[model samples]
Every structure is written in structure tokens, then in C-alpha cells.
Target: MFSGLPQDYSSITVTNDGWWPDTDVADFQSQRSIPASIKTETVASALLMAIGEANAELAAYQSAQRAKGFSSAKDVTGPSAGGVNQLCAQYLKIIFARAKAELMGEITSAEREKANPGQQSEDTRDRLLAEASFAIRNIMGHPRVTVDLI
Candidate 1:
């Protein structure tokens, strides 16, 4: 199905912190529809960076869960979505969204100009960034928006 692609197409797993499950680079590419032009190393680097940022962002939440007697994300009890733990899915969402956003930013101005050859109004990077933020908040059991009356 994927002919003429230079990618390895093998399942290369990216190891995350012990609290979080490992991520598959191939899955990320498939889910994001990342173009073959993007190198595997670039995608792997982005995923690693995203994993680090995600771990840091959710450090407090993880700590809270641990304090509550939960050892890892899988230990949390909740309804599963798509047969996967909710929190685990949300965590993956955060990592995948952030990695995709970073990869979108990797597209140079010239590459964009050549690809579009016209004005493109949509900013996918921004949307992905927002998605990452939303997933982070969801996993933390925080409201997407917290407003205080001024």
C-alpha cells in the first residue's frame, strides 16, 4: 500500500517514562498522515521531545495519582474508550498532538509556499496545539477553561 516511500514502515517504539506507556513512531505517522518527505529521525525526535514535554506537563497530575495509591496511568479506574484506558488514551493524545504540531512547524516557509501556491487560511499547528492543551487538561481532571469574574 505504501509504495515509493523511503520510510522503514517498521514498528519503531519510542520509550516514554515509566509512568507512561511507550509510543510507536509508525502509529504516529499513520495517524497523522505525515508525508514521506519528513524523515523518520525527524519524526522520532519530535515524538521524543513531545514525550518529554508531556511528562513535565503532567508531572503534578501523576504525582497526585501516585499519592492516591495509583502506581501508573493504567492503575486509574475509569471507562475505557476503544478498549484502551481513558487516561492512557488522553496521554497519547497529548503526545501525538504536540508532536504533530511540532512537525507542522518544521515545514519551512518555502515548502509551504510550494505546496500551496496560494493563500492557506487554516493553521493546523495551532489547532493541534490546542488539542494537546485540551487533552492535558482532560487528563488532569481540569476544566478546559477556568474563568474568574473580574
Candidate 2:
């Protein structure tokens, strides 16, 4: 009677697997605890916003690059998008590191003066340098470029 329909329907099957295993849940929970301060929803929203902004910025940058006739190794070859992406990543790393260092140095100096009240604290310099190093590491580890193939 059902011959007029699809033959794959006869092979259809269903399984009740229920929820994920306890070990998987526990692992996920443990990982969640590590970044508990940054909620997944908030991170996701921020990432989406960042991606939108990055896309707009990339479009503008590429337009300028094209207008200026900026040619790279990838422009001559078709698959050089990776090279361009790497260049942008390197540039971002340098810029962010410099800015972070400068800003941290200024803030640390101001805070040290306020806290010490006429005496300079050597620890502040060490702490600020350490904090800046950590921030630079984080920024370097993060993906800074979104590459698109033209």
C-alpha cells in the first residue's frame, strides 16, 4: 500500500539514548568552572558582536588595500589568503602589545604614586610588567584575524 512513497521509510529507525553520559557532563562542568567568571552566553554574545565589527573592519581595510593597490604574495597567487591573514595577525599582535604596555605603565605609575604617597614602590613596576606580559600572552593566543577568500 505504501509502495508509492519513499523506499527509505521502511529502513527508518529510532533510538532512545537519553541524556549525555555522566563523565561527559562532569568534564563539561569542570571546564565550565575554570571560566566561570565569563558566562557562556555573555561570551557568545560578545563574540558575535566582535565578529560583526571585525567583518566591517576587514571590509573597509580590504577596500583600502585594493584602492591603494597593495599587493602581497597571496595576491599574485590565488591561495595567499593565509599569508595575508598571518600578516594581519602579526600586525595586530604588535599594536595590541604596544598599547597594552603603554596603558598599563601609565595606570601602574599613577596607582603607585597614589598608594605610596611620596614613596616609590618597586613592586608596582614588577607587578605591572607581569600583568602586561600576561595580557600580551592572552592577546597573542587569541585569533585576531578573520580571513575571507576573495
Candidate 3:
């Protein structure tokens, strides 16, 4: 439903209550305490990486869709239950995980103490992270190709 790019990657929702039901943002949120300010650079890197991985895993399908003149997942409308949906869902998870990593950060003893009078190190070891899972790939099923030998 996009004339150009998909919903600016940041807008991709992971909640089942959102457009895609296959995944729930809560599933990931339950793992990590997402931060308020994630860096743009970090978000872009994570989004690009997630896109590459998904395109690689679903290359044939992606190629076929491109061949049909649909540039990317954004061009897709909805079945609400299909490849594009799954890809976007997975992509969102990855972006969230990578971006959130920066939020759940740790500072050295000198670092934290510098800001506070008696503070020590900011140990982020206890911080939880949402690992990007590929459940959508399995849910979407295998990519198929027509084998014709001349």
C-alpha cells in the first residue's frame, strides 16, 4: 500500500494487536525493557541487516515479487497472512532488538561515579535483550521455484 518505501521501518509494528498477528511485540518486549531513545544510526543498521537477512532467506520469493514490478514489501497490500507480512514482522523484531541494545547500556565505575557523588559502575549485565527470532520463516513456508531444463 506504499507508492515508494514501506512504512518507514521504525513504524513497523510487532504487536499481534497491530496489523500483523503472526507476531506479538509483547513477546519481544517481555524480554527487554525497551528504552526511550534509540539512536538513528543504530536503527538504520539494524533495519538494513534485517532486510538483507530476510531477502537472502527468501531470495527466490523476493526475486519473483520484484520481477512482477513490486519493488519491496511495502508494495504489498494485505492478506494479513502471507510472505510480506511475515518478512516485515521479522524485520521489525530485529530492528527493535538491535536498537534497544544501545538503551540497555553500561558505564564504567568512573563513568557513573562522575555523574553521581557515590555511584559505582552501571552494570548492564542484568539487562535483558530481545533476540530476533525467525519464527515467521517457518510460518511462511519454503520458497518454491519452477525447474525447467531446456
Candidate 4:
């Protein structure tokens, strides 16, 4: 395990292997073509929307749990809370992965000259970071839950 590593170590590596590939321009061009109808900005916006919705749902679920008095009366650090958080985290992770894949598709399409070829479009890194920021804001903006125990 990474017992002694700094907490910031977790933030250092963000890219997933499946999100992108190392291929030459010709190979990338030949393998897949970008859809003519889709724009990079549209793709980035869609990703932001999806991540925002997922994060909002997660925050709502957490707030509901807290409002039920279950979070206050019982040990929130117990197995159940941990399990729920893990499940939600996994869901968020999948959302992020899908977003990354979609951004990759846009990049590949653009690079292949299928849609916005030869144009300086938004790169994958910028798109992912934008979506992440949107997700973070969505989560933080949710109303906090309060529990009343009789």
C-alpha cells in the first residue's frame, strides 16, 4: 500500500490509459473518423453536463442520508457509510471515464481531419479539467443536510 506517500500523490496521475492512445497521425486518421456534425465545444459541454448531473445526484444522496439522523446517531465511519461512499465514488469515476473517452473521440476526430482538422481545437486535457471543475462546483453547491434525532 501507499502508506507513507503524500496525499498529493493521488492527484499527480489523472489520465487513464483507455482514454487515449499513442499512435501516429496516419494510423489515427485511418482507424477512426470524426463525425462531421459534432463540434468539440459541444462535446466538451455535454461532458460537463453529464458529470454535473452525476455529482448532483451523489450530493443529494449524501444529504438525504445525513438528514435521516442515521449519520448523526450512528458512526458515519462504519462499514455501511464507507460502502455507500465507495459506490458513489465508483459511479463518479465511471462518469469521468466516459467523459474522457468522449473527449478523446473528439480529439481523434479533429486530429484526423474529419471534423475540425487543421484547426486548433480544445485538447483533451483542457476539456477534462473543465468538466472536472463543473462537477466540483455541482457537488459543492448542493444544500447541506441536517438530522434531527428525537
Candidate 5:
């Protein structure tokens, strides 16, 4: 319910649709195939958890910006101004979708989840997770490893 927080979704989505809509997940659906046991309500709960986690991760940057006396994010308008905003949207969509999939017992490769036994291969889940973290770093920027005493 926070103001200036992307309205929990953008103009492209119906105002009430959870994080990333089912329609928006065609790639995941085709690749993984949704498990029959995962109910709509369960997905909703997972989405809430995912949104909370994403918000927590972004809080530090939001706090820093507020301390600078920027009235709010809405006042800014430009491609560069939208960097954090764009990243924030992408972060929520991806993190939530992944969480929901995991909750549905679909943690394996999308191909594996598709029941493709022949394609079952070495576990690359860790690598994918690392890549996701790298993307997040692009959004958040690398931490300062040293401080100058100037």
C-alpha cells in the first residue's frame, strides 16, 4: 500500500493480478508446466512472501534516497531516472515468479520439470541462482570494499 511504489504492478497488468501474471509466464509454463497440486491461493501466498523479500532487499537504497531529501520517486522522469525503478520492477517479477515455482515443487530445470527424462542433466540450478544474483548486483551496484579517509 506504499505510495510511489509502482502500484504493486504497472499499467500493463490488471490492478489486482498477483506479481507476474500467469499469462506473462508463458516461458515458464511451456518449459516447466505448472504442477497440478499447486492451488491458486498457494501461489498468491508465495507471491506475497516474494514481494516482501524483494522490498526488504530494496529498503536500504530507498532509505538512502529519502535521506537526500528527494521528495519521492514519482518526481523523477527520464530513462536514467528510471534505472532503479526499472530494476525494482524486474526484481519483483523475477523473484516472485521463481518463488512461486519453487513452492510448487518445480525447482528443477524447466526442461526437467517438463518431464523430459532424456534431457535430465547436471544440476545447473546453482549457476542460475548466481546469475540472478549478478543481475541484482547490476541493479544494486557492488558494495564499497574500501573507504577513503579524505
Candidate 6:
């Protein structure tokens, strides 16, 4: 319940569909503690952007998986939760973190507008992005960092 206001059923819906796992707006909001003031459209936009970015980042890995007879992320063998693929879970983490980071500024503004007055620090957003990057690397079976002699 947000500010005791009536819920926007429409906003609870995910605005886009794609080849990757579908993003549940309601789930994202709940898991990330998104306020109603941020509007579903804003969140959906951020999600779409994050999906695009993640897809772009994973293109090569996806291709390799396809070459190995896995047509989609879901087809790749991995640990499963409630039958959900681990890769799918990690992909959700990537998008959720990216989307939340993208909304940090709007979240702060919305909080201030609602008289909540809590600041969303840059460090928080950076951490969210780092989480996304970590998830990406995890799915890719790559280390979180690389070192090279210069």
C-alpha cells in the first residue's frame, strides 16, 4: 500500500515482452522497494533499457550457448529455483539492479516530492550497477575482475 492510495492496476503490469525472461513489474517494485510516486511508465522504461543493455552485453555468450545446442538462456543447464533456471534468476538480478540504479535519481526526487526526504546516494547506484555487472559475469562464467600487466 502506497500512501494509502488506491493501487494502479495498470502500473502493476509489465509493459514489454521479449525473448528473455519476462520482467514482472510488481515483483521488481516489491523486491526493490519502489515507491508508487515513480510511476509505472518510468519503471517500465528503465526496465526496457536495462533489458536492451543486458541483451547487448550477453550477445556473444548467448551465441556461444546457441552453438552448444542451447537456444535460449532457459535452455542452458543450471541450478534451478522452483523450476526457474539459475541463469534466469541471475538475468533478473542484472535487470533489476540496472533498472533500480537508473531510477535512483528519480527515486530521490520522488521521495523528496512525497516529503519522505531520503537521499539516494550515488554510492548506492554504483553498488546496484556493480551487482548487475557481477551477475553478468556470473552468467558468463567469468571472474569479477581482470588484471593485465601494462
Instruction: Please tell me which predicted candidate would have the highest TM-score against the true structure.
Output: 6
All models: lDDT? 0.80, 0.34, 0.41, 0.42, 0.43, 0.81
Task: Give per-residue CA lDDT, model 3, range 18-107, as digits (tens).
Answer: 222233333333334332134334444443444455445556655675687766655555444544564565555554544344333431
Query: C-alpha displacement of 79 in model 2, angstroms?
Result: 14
Error of 4 at 17 (Å): 28
Ranking by TM-score: 6, 1, 5, 3, 4, 2
* Candidate 2: residue pairs that collide: none
Cα lDDT tens digits, model 2, 1-150, are 223642221111111111100112122223222122333343333323333433343444445545766553124222225444443443333333332333333334544534643223445445534543443343335433447799
lDDT of 5 by residue, 28-56 (tens): 33333443334444444554565455556
Q: Would you give me the overall lDDT of model 6?
A: 0.81
Candidate 2's C-alpha runs over 4 A off are: 1-34, 63-85, 88-150
Structure candidate 4, residue pairs in collision: none
For candidate 2, the clash count comes to: 0
In lDDT terms, which candidate is top?
6
Query: Cα miss at 20, model 4 (Å)?
Result: 26
Model 2 C-alpha RMSD vs. true structure (Å) is 20.9
Span of 10 residues, lowest total lDDT, candidate 2? 14-23
Residue-level lDDT for 58 in candidate 6: 88
Backbone atom clashes (below 3 Å) for every candidate? 0, 0, 1, 0, 0, 0
27 in model 3: Cα distance from truth in Å? 16
TM-score for predicted model 1 compared with the true structure: 0.82
Q: What are the models' TM-scores?
A: 0.82, 0.25, 0.37, 0.29, 0.48, 0.84
Our model 5 lands, by Cα RMSD against the true structure, at: 10.7
